[model samples]
Target: MTSVVTSETRFVRSGDVDIAYQVVGQGERDIVVGIGWVSHLELLWELPETVHFLRRLQSCGRLILHDARGTGLSDRPARPATIDDLAEDLVAVLDAVGSERAVILGWVDKAAGAIALAARHPERVEALVLGEALATTVARDDHPEGLDPAVIENLAAAVEQGSWGTGALLPAIAPSVAHDPRVAAWWRRWERMSATPNMAAGMLRTLLDLDVRALLPAVTAPTLVLHRSENMLVPSAAVRRLAHDLPDGRLVELPGADLAAFFGDTDALLDEVEEFLTGTRTGADAGRAVLTMLVTDVVGSTALAAELGDHRWNELLDFHHREVRAALARHGGSEIDTAGDGFLAVFALPSRALACAREARERLAAGGLTIRAGLHSAEVVHLGAGVRGLGVHVAARVAASAGPGEIRATGTVADLVAGARAEFEELGEATLSGVPGLCRLTRLVDARGDA
Candidate 1:
């Protein structure tokens, strides 16, 4: 049995405030993790399960853990909290540790910050593991089963009022252990170790309002996204969407309803995280071939560009890029590459890639830029940079065959999409170019009723 590694707390000064961190294990490779908002490093160490999880990870390499500002042992700075500031705090902790680069593991809202740090300083991030991560929250406006604006406002108001003790925010935020006694106790303890209600409210507000969906493709490190299938606060679909959008990301769906990392069977989570970090379980390139592929393009972008002229068209294209990229990130569609006015994306799950394409087309329609998308599932070649194989070519052909503002998918894609909450209109069979045989086509339609 591996013994508990002795951990020592250390402080690093960043500007006017001091950031606290703990070091565990000892190895050539270092892993610096940025804990989620409202964490107490000392308190977390006391939990047997949490300790076990950390120890398991520590066995692989040295671990550098730190608390975010305004929470736990870290000195709270008067500056307004942003994801950048949180990342800087981690950087300060790393600088003090005398390490140049380290693997980063970020949970919950820290996902965005982790990606930001990785994007800004790729050299400092050897690898990245994001738990329940997202590039942004801009999709909240069009979330399939998201909370109503009024409900969200009321919950935010209650969090602002009662802060940690408020029952309203706890259920939605930590649905995994909303009813479990032990889990609830642990949550309460951790909440108390951090800031008061107002500060908690501020953190919650930042989480809800901040949107960084466009940055998914900018991340430079190999990333692993662990999303719970039953997460209630952030819909499982939303997390699925995130997996599809990241340039170098893979999604592993764990079975659990609890959002908190320590609430569920942490061993399984640690196993996945460890395998990804250490490259013990066949690196990111060795995943199976059954995945969804989505290809999208503007219907008449050349004509639109010619009519609008270079100046206005450039501005419009920028807006289009921002909107489309945001949608891909929100829906978890990794932007493989962009054509003149098209995007090629691959997904580990067929349903998510299809859903993301549907959502993108629907949302972009308002901006007068109609998009056609096509999806298919089959064996794919994972080359790290982009996916290859006949399935990708078939999906591309399906996209070319689609009409303006329509989503056309091959028979395989349609079959996988059939049971999803979204509805589609079957367009019957069509012989796709270079494909072996005739393929059935389907067009995605608004499915609010089915949802």
Candidate 2:
């Protein structure tokens, strides 16, 4: 069967309501796909970037796409729709298409329905992929910080007003879009075609009130949780919690913060998803390893900022940021986070981390920037975004102890580096404040030597 064009609208009978859908690709493998709220299949195809991502997925297998009720071409049934109803729509669509079982790919708000379906009817779902998912609308009661109610209210109002196109919504959805004229225009057009302000607001509220923490363990199918390390929409901790709660779920952290799947590095996302679904990649066996952690910071950044003034300082800081980022990329170090004038990064190998730190310090010194770096190796929690553990903390502390243009390493790291044929001097065992017990540190090179 030839795939339906985006503009071609069709409907599946779901009891009393007709749910609108579009079929794409003609592969034998069937996949039922659900997009987040406010999707216009036709409009989506008009955007080359969005269509490219969809077409690529279609090339691998058939894609069954649908608009959830109350948005797009689907019948806007009344208020207070639950994920259960949304899941029912999915089942109805499958029944209409005569698909016995298929992989389910759901993004953003639809993640709740995807989870609910996988939990309720494991027989119908072969595998599952949820991107930018949320476990609960209200953070766990144990969560120390929940989203501010005022902020949520304002966001809702903005969506309600249909001001998402002009206001912060555009810039917020894809921050990097502002830098690219073509992409920015496409985003604005896509948003306009997708949903009205009220519809968007309603869906936003639906997502906010949703909490699927209780349904996680019931999910039996192989599941992949795709999230960006820097996602501003959903908290990283929440995604971590989802992985922890799901019985067969694995996490893959993509690099960019663009919440829209089609916006950034979609090829990587597709590869990971396909690999997980097929037997080629086992999420359990891959990505788990002990690695060296590194933290680096500009020396006297506040003082320098004051000296250079805000604009000039920001300009210089931008240059510094680019330099450090390029150095990290060249050395195979994954940047974890950027805080003011500092960075947190990780390398899978201790030697790489050590070498990268030395290179970074040397490179920055030439740029009129002074840097200190610390490295440690321990059983690091590889969250795909960055490494975390006591080892990471120790590395940060050691970096703090180092003077400008110096590199330091914890005793654990030093031990790993002992036979690596690198020159180093012991800094002696010292009581690291807040860290338990004494830590032996080594200075990779004396500060004066670099001078």
Candidate 3:
């Protein structure tokens, strides 16, 4: 339903509490979303990534998002909610929306309640999709792969000690976007609006205490378990066991470490979900995507060519190209184009792009050829073999502004990779030729560690 707005929140009563929910789009089937920890019904639409994720799910079916009891706009009970209470609240929201059966899309720690519901009332859940989900958070003798109880306890203690509204949890949830100033600001407000410090801490403890391993066999619906290949938050053994125990479950590990389903490679994650539900994959258009553009130019190319003569210069330039290409391949980059004594590439992540730039610089220097590079992150339009957008121009201009052997990045790129091995020194504002206004540029002083 294009007319459906995310801001128009509605309420559904489950027992004495009022659960807040919003509906968007219409399709043959319904998809209900349940996130781990806390979430704000309206705040979920603030970020572009989150909006895109919700829309992608909507593309395949009618989407339902609700705030569980004790969090967000829902009534915060004095006591914490249990798995049974959460299941009832979910059912209440489904009934309010007139959904007979819907695909339960649960994320991270919230999957326990969804699993319990699926087992208890299989008729209400058509299918299940769990992303970065854990059957249990605490380690048991039978499930030793689960998280240490002490670690979760320490985290809950920190949450109780005034760490709720400061955006401290963003890194563990979505490290890719946590360092971004805009994202950090939005997250701080999200945390404050979702729950108070005590409420969040209590929820953490309750979620950790939940164990749904015994319910796996009773969940008769087809299940898809999606996990990130490099996710550091959840142990791989726990996820593997989750898939193994489910009667009809299949595991697919995608590429990324962000535990938050809306961040990282959301399009890839959605592809799997859509295919599982619809039996076919109608993927998002690749015409435009948020990518990091990297541009590199050799220093004094014309003069050096004249000094070394055409034959020798050609050999060195050829070696430089080979070295740069090698670096790109090593750092997970796609070479978009190459101009005279210059190269252009793009990376899905800003950290990888930064590392590629650094590696290329060092490789070229070793070969007696020095280069300057620039990186910028933005939405670029892909046409034919190359990309076209103001972002590409900004990257080229930034590269032109860099000195020999220097790697420069726009503020957008720098902000995205703040916690990575890279470090930047602000170069203030520069008039990027042909682009509008002044752009803040940061010099990549060091990007030497593993990204």
Candidate 4:
């Protein structure tokens, strides 16, 4: 069974504050992950993507995950925390774990603290890795690399009044998984658990005001700076400057606009990190993969069963099941489950799944029966002789939303089967129950101009 990770979280005294930290896996080398802005050590494990990312990192080295002072489970600073405080908090965690030297992978504002530690306490930092690293947040006349002051202002406003605790900012940070209801809901709770609206806004302002450009030159550790090519917040030229300013820095610009490291194309991001840390990029787990899902349900099955009585309905259902099994075999789909008058199956190719769904609906219609089908492509956890994941839930929801004799799919299905000669009619956005946000649904039309 695929389950969310739970670790024994502990706290260490960092000056006057108690910083919460979790140690995962055991290795000769240690990896201190500096998650920036806001985070909750326990709530983050609720996300499957984060679990996968952490497990992969554990494969490479021991992971030292912690929430910064004044955030998550840590004690709030009596005064506005400074960059010096952030660096010291990290050092304190290292001491608690007995890690004399470790690779520091800093993200966003936390990168400033990492750079400070590398410069101030060079012996403790074995190597440095940064993602979406910031040199300066506010633009200045002397430093053309800084961000526009308005950008930070708008963000502060969002956290303070607009969308704090709602996960509305997820789209801006991680657009790739914005449509997934499970992730959306978890992120909403994560936001709430991380900090209150006022405290979050205050932390945002404090972190943005941090400037680490001066410390870059003093970092003696070999540094790898990773930044997204189409980052929404940080300008590419500015990140390039950050790399150039560092004495022993190497810059690698990855694809995607998501500022969060574990969001879009996570495998690609992890590949880089693992290679940089251990000189080998570990392969992904064999049990997890992206698969296209198809779910079909007989419309008004209860009424039909009542009208036809037990014997007649049973005979008809048996025929329908046989036909569906034949269709699955013909299209290379693996039938995962059959619940009452519904069928759930998975296909390796989106086009094949679409074709099978269309064929099964047509076959059932010809037999005086009709089914509404839904298709979606997403990552799935392969269970013993079956599969499960958010994609399966999404497919079931899409199927439920379809009209009788109609086929519907998420926008992702349309994107995946682009050249399959499939026609799709926009069904617009829908607010599915149990799903956090609106999802874009599309009606799949038959290629032969048949409804």
lDDT against the true structure, each candidate: 0.74, 0.76, 0.86, 0.84
Tens-place lDDT digits, model 2, residues 1-451: 1333443668987767788887775675778777766677666666656765675566556788888887777777667358888888889988877788888998877888889998898899988899888688556576422334555677789877657665357566666565677777776776666666676777777766777877888899988999888767677777777876789989998898877787777767877876776644333223346877889999999999999999999998898889888878887988888998899988878787887787787778888999988888877644424554687788889999999888888877777766676767988998776789999988875322211
**lDDT per residue as tens, model 3, 1-451:** 2323554799988999999998887889999999778889888977766776786788787889999898999999997889889889989999999999999988876688789889999999999998776777777877887876676788789889888899887887788898899889998998999998999999888867888888988999999999897887787788888998999998999888898898888889988998898877664553478899999999999999999998999899889889999999999999999997899899999999998988898888988899999999999865435676899999999999999999999999999998897889999998877999999999988766858
lDDT of 2 at 150: 58
Model 1 Cα lDDT, one tens digit per residue, 1-451: 2344557777888767788888887876898776665778887776554665576667667888888887778876553368787677778888998889988888877777788788777888888888877656535554443223455456557767655653445576566557866656766777777766666656766776655576667787888888778776556676777777777878999987666676676667777886876657432233236767888899898899999999998887777788878877877778888877888988877777876886787778888889898898888754435666788889899999989988877777767766677777888988888988888888877555221
Write the residue-wise lDDT of candidate 4 on 247-343 in tens digits.
Answer: 8988999899888887887778888887888787654564578999999989999999999999999999998899899889989999999998999
What is the alpha-carbon lDDT of model 3 when measured against the actual structure?
0.86
Clashing residue pairs, backbone N/CA/C < 3 A, model 1: 176-258, 241-331, 241-332, 242-332, 244-332, 244-333, 244-334, 245-332, 245-333, 245-334
Which ranges in model 4 have alpha carbons more than 4 Å from their true place? Answer: 1-5, 78-80, 285-451
Best by lDDT: 3
Q: What TM-score does prediction 2 earn?
A: 0.59
Ten-residue region with minimum lDDT total, candidate 4: 1-10
The positional error of residue 375 in candidate 3, measured at the CA in angstroms, is 19
Q: Among all windows of ten consecutive residues in candidate 1, which has the lowest summed lDDT? A: 279-288
What is the number of backbone collisions in each predicted candidate, taken in the order shown?
10, 0, 2, 0
TM-score of each: 0.57, 0.59, 0.66, 0.67
Task: List the candidates ranked by lDDT, beginning with the highest.
Answer: 3, 4, 2, 1
